[model samples]
Target chain A: MSTVLQSLSTELADAVESAGRAVVAIHARRRIPASGVHWQPGVVVATNHTINRDENITLTLPDGTTAPASLAGRDPSTDLAVLKLAGQSLPVASLRRDAPPKIGELVIALGRPGPGLTASWGVVSRADGPWRTWQGAEIDSLLRLDLAIYDGFSGGPLIDAAGRVLGINTSALARGVPVTIPIATVERIVTELLERGNIRRAYLGIGTQPVRVPESLARKLELKSDLALLIVSLESGGPADRDGLLLGDVLLELDGTAVNDASDVLAKLGGDRVGKPLAARLIRGGQVKALQLTPGERPTSRAA
Target chain B: MTASMTAGLAQEVAAAVDQLRQITVQVRTHRAATGAGILWNGGEPEGPGLVITNAHVVEGERATVELSDGTAARARLVARDLRRDLAALEFEPGRAVVGAVVRDSPPLRVGELVIALGHPGGLTGAATLGIIHRAESDREGRTPRWIRADVRLAPGFSGGPLADATGRLVGVNTMMQGGLALAIPAVAVEAWVRRSQTMAVS
Candidate 1:
């Protein structure tokens, strides 16, 4: 018993010590607190939602010192962003390249939200995903954590018991619900954001609102979700306008994924789908209609 | 997608969860205030036992305790210390209630294995595991000094037990302090219970 306890103690202590070195606190506008990982030398990856402004970014490193960081790029579709610092190089977190973590294994979310490191431990609540968020952006994997993502943990790493970072935990895009943006997705988004300033998203050029699908129509179309998107307006000369999409149509499905709300349509509008012809199924005049329309590039006028 | 349930650690955790399930129960107060509490002997088994929880989780003067087997009875709020965030509820003895043997807590070092049982987010009988981060005194060195641990606790987890790897209750899961999950040492809770018992007898 003594031996078992001692071995476990050593493992956990080492995990915390090594992982803490890479966790840094990020402060954006209004002093909104967050955590980030030193994935690459002098490159910190954090969540985009907690970061309201790109200018005047500051980071608190593990050595108990602060440094000014510059925003390199950010992609809100995946809720990930990158920052560059001219400060000293920190040891990058070791990421496990082995099999994906099991559902019930021990995992810890660590961050230096303040002067010292703060840790939260729990099991992987759920790890099954090749699914898409409501924004319709592709997520390589979805990892739901039972651990609490407290004030400074939004961008922290959810590492295994061995201290290998599994993913960047963020609740920003998930509406405060903890979801891990996996390493594969993080690398892809960071590369694109660094090159393009923002990830391109396809748009149908229609402002829509969520409304309940009439029960009669739902049963007729065999739709899974009871809600649909009702077109309120359109960007003149945009994809929907060019396709003669009416203003009163309620979107039921886009590219086979059921559109439950405005977010559902927006989710599938990510840059990868831009310029591709997509099948939009809508209910016009109480009848399900299918239309072929090529998605246009999403406007970049919204403030970050 | 794959099972990491190796034979050794999986067996140990399963056994501990089984032992913990026997003593854990749900505490309910008015206006839907709910949390987890542990059953313990108030003084003697023949006398009514008490359900221990956090003072901030005190739902009302008369709180309902639901046992593991789903039996419930209203427990009287016998004593409460808000300063320590500890509360003890005396209720009728049903069957036999086993109290958790809390360790001295000092011998526990940083990174020692620990498990927590609580009703977090309204879900009862939930258990999560972590390690002790290290115990430290607050700035003022006043009451409610804590041994912070890595075990995660949500809103409904307040007033529950942070047990050792062997399932012995070592601390009461309180709130977060200094960015870590904080718990009141079991010695503090035991001392509070002793004072409450002495006061009742006097």
Candidate 2:
């Protein structure tokens, strides 16, 4: 090999060595095996979809020792779960918040599918986002890897050529698409889970679905999107109903944010907007009407 | 890896790619398969011409072996050990292919550099670089069952060679676990092939 290639491989090998140390092999399910990476000193972040039972989880440390872990919190919308290892100290993977890896840059995915640390190499296919998954989960950062995910790959760390973690890759939210939940998203989710135990969402008390807006009305309204929310049902005297929103009224925007679909509305109704008066613009018949609604506390009974 | 769709490789190819490709074969099973194989004659005086691949690569009893130079041959299943995912095929030694150089590289340590040569996802002659993630026996003390590496092996990479930095075959790329490439070690492949040939002779 040329000196340049040798140097590249050697450097990459070093990165995987340090980063793989933070990767833990998680046997989240009694039957199915998965992987998790340490986000904090004792906190491991994993994909929520694989955690069948809420309790009695096991994590295989890089040293090959088993330790009991308890689920701290889980957000199904984003498919991320946090597990706290009992009295165990594991190496925390360093999250790179600086410049992102450029497109075409080499990336490696590390996981503990078995007792051993397994690796997969790919390239950063799509790295720009503050996008939402198809399930309507709001992600602060998004990464679509060119890498193909296999068994136990969900919840593993996706590292750049330098070994810095890009995010936690999960198959849950992507619906078979390879998506990586970036480090910033992992940090945010883990913080919320550690502090509040769950992501707080605002309640609209209305069921809605995405519908296409009439071209004539959309152009006159100077709307940027072709999709709008069609209100299906209002929870008796709920936020939308109380705010003078009638059934069948098309929702265009909430607090200046476009409500293109049900997920878009859900994405806007985050916990921060709860108890806040939000200006909602909707098209009733052929006219666009603006109304004010104070978002209420979301019921904990509602599954994400 | 969404940065760019790299048809050739996710990472850059090194100086050893040409050497690696010569011994690599795009091993396609008659069961409608996608896999890579290594051309190994084993220096056997009688019926030594063989193609080494994963047991799962071949279906029924027949397969089409495409050599590195694009020569295709019809091969018959010789022997297989499903437990280890290793199998051998007897074919006419038409291509002057040499067995992969088996180096003395042993005690495979984590973070050691390696490369994988295979036809991943039907993209023939693709290569990926990685490190030896782990190399060990299972709980049953099965020595060198798998060589776990970070090198990406997609649907078509199975049965290819996972070689060391020097381009010597160390393992036969097989299945994947959690996206990591799993391979049957070269030593294990040699043993399996030797045992299968002896059985065929008897």
DockQ of each: 0.15, 0.27
lDDT (tens digit, per residue) of candidate 1 on A19-121: 8889898988475478999988878899887788879998888877899999988766677889988858789988886778779878877766666676767
Write candidate 2's Cα lDDT for B7-56 as tens digits. Answer: 22323354578788988887776545468888776654355458889888
Badly placed stretches (over 4 Å) of model 2 are: A1-10, A209-229, A256-260, A281-290, A301-304, B1-15, B21-99, B108-136, B139-142, B146-161, B172-183, B192-202
Is model 2 an incorrect, acceptable, medium or high docking prediction?
Answer: acceptable
TM-score of 2: 0.76
Fraction of native contacts (fnat) of each candidate: 0.20, 0.30
Please give me the total number of clashing residue pairs in predicted model 2. Answer: 13
What is the number of backbone collisions in each predicted candidate, taken in the order shown? 5, 13
Which pairs in model 1 have colliding backbones? Answer: A135-A267, A136-A267, A136-A268, A200-A271, B54-B159
Across A1-304, the per-residue lDDT of candidate 2 in tens digits comes to 3444556556666777889889887776777579998988889999888887776788888888989888998887788889998687677898888976667777877777777766666788876768876655678866777865656778888887778888898877766877788877788889999998887878888988889987887899888887889989998878877888888989888889988767667777778988899889888878889999888877653243
